[model samples]
Structures are given as C-alpha cells and as structure tokens.
Target: MYSLLFYLALRDAWNLGAIDPTSGTATLLEVTRVLGDMYSKGFRPRRSLMFCSWGAEEYGLVGSIEYVQEYVKVLGARVVSYLNLDVAVSGNYTIRSTASPLLVDAIIEASKMVPSAYDSPEQTVYDKWKKVRWNNVTNEPIIGNGLGSGSDYLGFDQLAGSSNFDASYTFNPADHGNLGSYPLYHTSYEVFSMVKKFVDPEFQAHRALGQFTGVLALILCETPVLPFNVNRYTSALRQTIDSFKTNDSTMFDLLRSATNDFGIAAEEFVARSKSMDVKNPYVIRAYNDQLLQLERAFLNPLGQGGAYSDMK
Candidate 1:
C-alpha cells in the first residue's frame, strides 16, 4: 500500500486574516486534486493508495503519530511507502525533498517527468533540482536522506518503518537571507491571496508539485519490480559512518566490515530481483515483500533513548 498524508491544521496565533492557506490548505488541495484527476482519467492502481488528511499536526504531530502507534504492526507489514505534503507550494524556485534512501531513484524519476514551474518548455523539475541544488561531492541533485522529526512522515519512517518522504516547491533561501522557511510562514499573511500575488501567482508551482507527487505514487503502485535502489542504502551507511570522528580503530573496523557485508548482500538482492520469474505471483510477492520490509529491519521496537516512538 502507498499512502499520501496532508495536514489540515495551522499554527495557534490569532491573526487578522482568517486564511491559512499556504501551510496546510494548499497542500490538501493539491493532493486531493491530483487524486480526483487520476480517478477522472480512469487510472486504476495495481496496489492500494491511501489519502490521509491529518489533524493537529501543528500540535506536535498528534494525529499521524497516534495513528501509526495504533496500527504499527498492520502498517509495517503492508505499507510500501508514505508520501507527505505539508507545504506543497511555499515558493517556486525549485523542488526540494527529504526521503528515505530507498526512494531516491523514484523521486528523481518522477521529477524528470514533471515540467519546471517557471522554466523553459524543455526544462524539467529534475533539471531545476540539479542546477539549483545539488551535492558538491557527487555533482548530482541533492536530496535529504534523513527524515528528521518534523512532518507527518516521522511516524511512518521511525515507528512504522515504512519508506517515506516529504517534498515542497520552495523558494531559494539566498533570496530571503537564508531564513529557515518562507517569510510569511505561520503568519496572518499566509493566505490564498499571498500565494497568488507573490509565491505562485499562476499556480504553476502547485501544479508541478501535484504532478510530480502523483507520478511518484503511480510509479510505486504500478511498477512490478518495486523501483527501489537498495544500493543507495550502502552509500548512505558508509557516508554516515565516515562522519564519526572516533579514535577507536577497533570499533571503526567493525562498523566498516559490517557495512561491506551489507553492501554485498544488497548487490546480491538486486541480482536476484533481475532474474526472478515475474510471471509467478508468489515469486513477485516474495521479492516485493523483502524490499518493503528492508527498512523495518533497521527499527528497534524498544525505541531510541527510552522513547519508543523513535525506533528508527
């Protein structure tokens, strides 16, 4: 199963403007609109797709976290991926995403299929992502690998152990003195008119985000081999392990050896997937189940730092 989560709550401060469209309302509209369009076009998914509108997100992720806690086992066994859209269109400078390592390839593929919000006809979201934001070491479009404690995706990522992601069409931070978020964030000025007048007047950014996210969901639902790149996990692990500046050589060697063994296993898994008999439903289910549960294996059910919810 694939799930799409959009929050329906806003900050607590009272303001003159009753409209709090940018943070949550716009995201909900884009997600529902895409789902409606998909239905109208008569596109039926091979796998299950869920549309979830979470409440009280601004009140410490109350809605989504509780839901995951209630159904962790069921979700862990069944859910393949979770896509969260909290602020879909804050700005249109470029598309930004933070995702699990397993989903990097799918996100890139979906971005390539969607056109840029304000670029030339031939330019795609992938092109903008590469040109505007990328990794210096690899010279490729950059994506956040860690799903930090912030949106609705946290529960799905850490607790349920479902591969998950959050994305937005964002403004360039340099243009706003490198502020954490847009200037009107959580303010009275975050109304529909604000989005129309300044952020995305033509709503092209919103449309682009909708199409990108929808295409990603479709890829997950329709693909037979489960478009996951397990090899990405190897790279992520190595990079993370390298970040530690510990002087304990013994511990470091143990960690490196473990990562190497995991890399070998990942390669073998990919090779097996390629040679699998796709005609057999049992075989397909077995292969796909491994891919789905790979992330769950990293979870510690007892939780991290005495907090059960921080299992991942």
Candidate 2:
C-alpha cells in the first residue's frame, strides 16, 4: 500500500509538471505539498502525523533538530519509534537495522523472518543458512550503527527519546555499470530512468523494507510492555563519567582521587546492604531506602531559582 502511494505520488508530481530537472528544489516542494495535504486530511484526533521535508540535511541535521525542539512535547510520546529510510531505493537485498538494546531482541526476531538472497549450489535446499566462522555460529544480519547526528532519526533518538532504526542494504557494490546505483546519490544525475534501471531493478529491496517497517510498527502498536533496561542506563552513565575524566587531565586528577574514595565507601555500603539478606524487615527497608536515595542524587530540581541544581 505504501509503495503504491509513493509511486502514485511520484507519478502525480511528474504528470503535473512538478519535476524540476535542475536543483531538485521542485521535487522537495512537491513532496512537501503532498505531505501537507496528507497531514490536513489523513490525520485524526488522538492520532497526529507530521510530514517533514527537511532542508539542508546534507549540510547538517539542522531542519529536523529545529522541528524537534519546536514540537517535542506535542509529538514525543505518540512517536513510539522512528524508522528512517533515506536511500532505501537502492542497495542490495541484505538488511541492516540498528536500534537501542531494548529493541535489539525484537529486531533480531524480525530479521530471522526475512529470507536472505544468498545462495549455495552444494546445498539443494534454499533456506536461511547460518554463516559460521572459526567454529562460531554467526546468523546475525548486518545491523547498522546507532543513531548519531546524521540522518532524520538523530534528533528524535537523542532529544525526544524515541527508539530509532535506520535500515539499508548494499547488494552489489562493484556494479558501477548501472547508472541507477550510487552515482545518482547527492549528484545532478539522479533521474527516473537511472532509478528504475539500477537503484531498484525489481523493487525487491523496497518490498523488504516495507515488510520490516510494517512488522516493527505492528509490534509497537500491540506490545503492552515498553522494554527498558535500567542496567544499560547505569552502565552508559558510568562510561560517560569515565570519558569526561579521560578527556580533561586537570579534572581527571581531581575527580580520580575523589572517585576513588567515593567508590570504596560505596562498595562497602553495597556489601553491607547485601549482607543484611533475610534479616529484620526494618534493616532490609533501610538498605533499600539508601539505594533509592543514591538514585535520587542524580536528579535535578524541576523548576525555578537555584532549585534546578542536583543534590549531588
């Protein structure tokens, strides 16, 4: 359905003389106008859609970030996840999806359902064969890197706290004969003929992308529990502190000594708390209370005055 919609959109733009063969400005404007139409008529109460045709994305993630800051509170929670598809038109049948660790298991399960394009002549049966190396089982798909300040998903993942996935495939990197391939990327030569011939010859990759995104969206809509790992948060925070110390020598020396003393005390406290075990209920409560208090130390004041300072 989405593919048909996309094709129709392209067709309508072409038929209406909206194609600007020069600077790609007309293409952007056409897309923006179509999105605006969709937003006005297609969106419903309790369900909203923001169609963003970002400008200067190649320069940096400026447009998306500005949109995020402007409408974060309004759109944040409703946006369960973000699936970015910048150059989905091209690439191999190979699937690459990257998301937070909380969503990693879900993504792995989804990947297992996607049939691979690789083949082996010796094996008569065409099945999803596991790639092994040095006695180690390797059945994992080529997952891309996590969200950074690059594509459209960056602002949502970083600031708005949305789980974001960027997926693509590089089928035949050596096939330069096809004008529809990488040559059109960020260049003046990108056209319908080249895209139709090389980028997506059969649109199989496009179909696979639609399938992947459909599954992910269904999972998000149906799943009752939102997977969140506190341990991951704790580890990330620890690494951030370590990185800050490593980057600044003067602060490193000062913080290193203080952290050493604090670490010893914290370790001792944790040990004693664990030792309490099945002792008096009051003791257990006290230990749990102390641990909770430790978490509170990281919190900053919510509003007004010097009240926004962290207790720590």
Candidate 3:
C-alpha cells in the first residue's frame, strides 16, 4: 500500500550517501530488546506487535503517512498505540516523554526502570527527566505537551488519529535555549562524529532510549488496562487555558466551564476503565478499542495541508 512515487524524494536520493545518524546503535539496541522480549516474555501480548522502519520520513513524513493511509481501517480497529523511535540519541537529556493522555503514565513508568544519563545507578531515567522538565517548565513533573507534527509521528497521530507519542534523550542548549544546533543537519556533515563527540559522547543515551522505547511498547501491548490518563489530559488542558483568561473573558470563561466539566467526566472514565476485568479477553478488546478511537475525536476534518497543521 506504500506509495512508491512518494517514497524517493529528490533531495534524499541525492544527499543520502553516508551512515545513519544513529550510527546503528538505536537499531542494534532495538534488535536486542526484541529478541529478549520474545525469548523471555514469550509473546504474552494480548495483541500482535509491529516494528516499522520508515524510509521517507524527512520528505514530509512520506513513508509513514503512506503506510497509515494503506492500513487506516485495520490500524484504527486493532492498534492500541504507536510509539515512535526517531533521532534516538539527539543530545543527552535523560528522557523527554511527551505523548497523548493514554501514554503519559506508561512513559513515566518505563523511564523509572532505565538508567539515568546523570550519575548514580539509583537515579532512574524518570528522575532525570522530571528534573529537566521541572527546570524548564513547571514545579512538578507533569506529563505535558501533546505531540505536534514534525516527523513520522505525524502519520500515526494527525493522519490516522491514533494514540501516539515520540521520545528521545535530548535537551541540548543549542537546539532550544541559548545554543544552536549543529549546522550539519540534513547534510553529509551530520555524521557519527557530531552525534558521538557533541550529541552523546558516552552513547549510554542510546541504550537508555532503547530501554525506554521497549518498555513503553511492551506496556501498551501487554497491559490489561491501557496506561492512558484522561484526567491528566483534562487537567493540563484546563491549566493551559486558564493562563489566558484576560484575552477574551467571554470565550475564556466558556472554555473554562467546558474543560472543568470534561475534567470531572475524565476522572470517572479513568476509574471505570482501570477497574475492568483483567482476565476477560473480550473486555480488554472492547476497552482497547475505545482507547484507540479516542484520538480521532481531536482530528480536524479539514486539516489537510502543511507540515504544521491544526489537527495536533
């Protein structure tokens, strides 16, 4: 179902002449985890698993968008979630877990299991992630920010309206704050040297990234009650909208009222969903399907143009 015509973008075909930016570390780690999961866990998932290697991500998410277009119906019906693994070792941030409401808890839990990029084995990835997040954004470690259109994640989220997210161990001063990114991006200069020497000198970040990815993926597939936080989403939305009450009191007041009502409903929904019977496969399927369709409610039916759309 892939669109061959869209697969080979002209720039990628000509400029892509060296090794991957990850230097094979992310791929190798993924392989190791997959083999381990199969052997140790023995395919205990309530649903089938999938691993995707998208080809034309840089070309406006061509590969993933086409794949989702191909499998939209089946994916919507059966897929529990989508976790993206791109730019595995971006910088050296311990972990930056940003996702839809349903995935925030799973991401945080997985982070607690992996080693921190900081010192001490006792300090888990979640500790570092929360510290970084707090230093940058809020007082507490909140599951903040919905995924926006940028990479392959766009396909699963914007196009397919699937519960999705992307994680990476990166928070370079250059990319966000006072520093600037490596000028070699999208060029031959964007080689292993930059990633190893500047981005992730120790390469432990790559392993941490892999562990986080594997854990979150397994949780989605195996957990009887999907690790989504409807209340968190509602709460965050309320907090965010509350910031601009002065702009237009009428509309802002209306929004406040709506989100507050939604928050109450979300709390009840979370309790009900979590209380489901774990032993009943039929109940799990029904509950999982509800989680899958939840994302589609946010899709703007007219959101069809540009890299930065209104959908996400």
Candidate 4:
C-alpha cells in the first residue's frame, strides 16, 4: 500500500509546482507520443505493442512487482524483453543504461539511429555515449550489463526472467560529486522551471530520448531474427567469474572451464540463429522462443540463497 504521508507530501509538492516529471511523466510522454506518431504515419508493427504505467513505483516498485508476480508464468514464457524509462530525462548530459547483455547490440544500434540532443547534427547518441564512457579494450561504449534494485525493470528481470532494459539521459556524475542520481531527485525543487531552465533547456533531449526509445522498440518488434547478442553473455559471465577474489584456485579453474564451454555453445547458437529459415512461421517462432527463453534458463525457481525476491 502507498504511504498516506507520502501521498500528502506529493500533493503538497504538486500544488507548489513540484512536478515529478522525471519519475515517470517524461517517459509516459515519450512513449505515448512515439506510438501516436507511428499510428499517424500508418506504421504497423508485426508484433503487439503494449504500454504500461504502474502506480506506487516510488513506493518500492510495488505495482510492477505485484503485476509480474501474478503473470510470472506467461511473461517468463512469452515475453521477449522489458524496456523501462523511469527518470527518462533527469539530465541532458548523456544516456546511461543497465540492461541484459542480450540486448546490448540492439541498444547500440538504436543509439546510432537517434541524433544526440547536444551535439552537431551529424553526431548521434552512440557518438556521445561512446565519448562519455569508452571501453579501451573493445573500443565500444560501456553499457552496464547488470540491474540493481531500482526501477520497474527489476520484476521483469528477476521474477519474470525476461531480458530487461532501463535507461536515462543523465547528467555527468563527475559534475555532481558522483551522486547516485540527479541533485533534485524527488525533491520539491524538481519543478518544470528547473528542467526547462537548467536540465533540458531546448527540450531536444526529450525528443532525442523519445526517438531512441522508439527505435529500440521497433527493432525488438520488427526484427525477423531477435537482435540478441548471445556471445556477449559469455564475456559477461567470464568477467564476473574473474572478478571474484577468492583464493580457491580449483573452484576458479572449474568456473573458467565452464565459462569457456558456454562461450563455445553461444557461438554455435549464434551461427544457428543466423542460418535459420526466417520465412517459415514455425521455424521463426521456435528460433525466437530460444532467444526469449535463454535468460529464463538462468533463473533458479527457488531463488538465490533461498530468497525468492533475489531470483535472477
């Protein structure tokens, strides 16, 4: 249940012009406008499109968690991914994301398609994102591969066992003393004036975000072969395994071997996906199902350490 005091506080804030647009309103505007624009243009997606707005998200993601818990079986089996946009435009600096490794390629592709809000017309979101955080080894923008307990994507990621994506066009943390979020987050000072004057003065960031999100959604819905990077998961797993500081050499070696084998299998899977018959509806459905259910295969039905909420 939502806290009474919190509701009163929010109402008081709203009366004083403290609109919590970043929390969800901005995203709602973006997603809705994109869908409306698509409809106006007579574009129809091959797959279904669903828009979700959950209540009490600030109250520990209460709404989304309950919904996922109720539909976990169906979502786990049929849902391809969850794209979250909470705090859509807290800053005008650059895009930040925490997503399942499977979606890294699709996200990058979408970024490349959307022009950056702050840069020259030729510069794209991918350019700005790569400039902000580059991986020296891979020469690519460093997108996070893990999700923390923060937004609505948590339920879809852990409970529904679906690949999920959460993103924001955020401010530079270096300028804000490396705070976890923007300065006026959930504060009375988070008014429309503040966003207009300081955060996104021209509203270009909002438009860019809408385009990027829309393109990503289209990629997920229209691609004949699911644009999942299965091989990327192998590297993610290897990195996670290597990050452990345990002195257990034997255990580490075993983990490395397993990761290596997983990489080989992932390579095979990618090859098969590339060579599959996309014209046959049954073949396409089965191939897509394999991609969709790969993340679910990692879930432990009983949960992590016997804690049901921690399953992933």
Best by lDDT: 1
lDDT of 1 by residue, 140-210 (tens): 78988878887777788888888888888889999889988776667777666777789888888887877
Question: Candidates sorted by TM-score, descending order?
Answer: 1, 4, 3, 2
Q: Model 4 RMSD to the real structure? A: 5.6
TM-score of 4: 0.88
Give all candidates' CA lDDT scores: 0.78, 0.45, 0.62, 0.74
Q: Each model's TM-score, in the order given?
A: 0.89, 0.52, 0.80, 0.88
Residue 177 C-alpha lDDT in model 1? 92
TM-score of 2: 0.52
Residue 101's lDDT in candidate 4: 93
lDDT of 1 at 114: 92
Clashing pairs in 2: 92-171
Best-first order by lDDT: 1, 4, 3, 2
Clashes of each: 0, 1, 3, 0
lDDT string for model 2 (1-312, tens) is 010001111111112121111112332344445545655896322222233345545556566767766765543434555656555444543554555543555565555555443333232111222341111222443343356665666666655555556655444444556344354454545665665575556555455555554455445434333332223333333444676634546766665666566566666765664566554656654553343234224323331125322211
Cα-based lDDT at residue 281, candidate 3: 78
Q: After superposing candidate 1, which stretches have Cα over 4 Å from the reference?
A: 1-24, 246-251, 304-312
Look at candidate 3 and tell me the lDDT of residue 74.
65
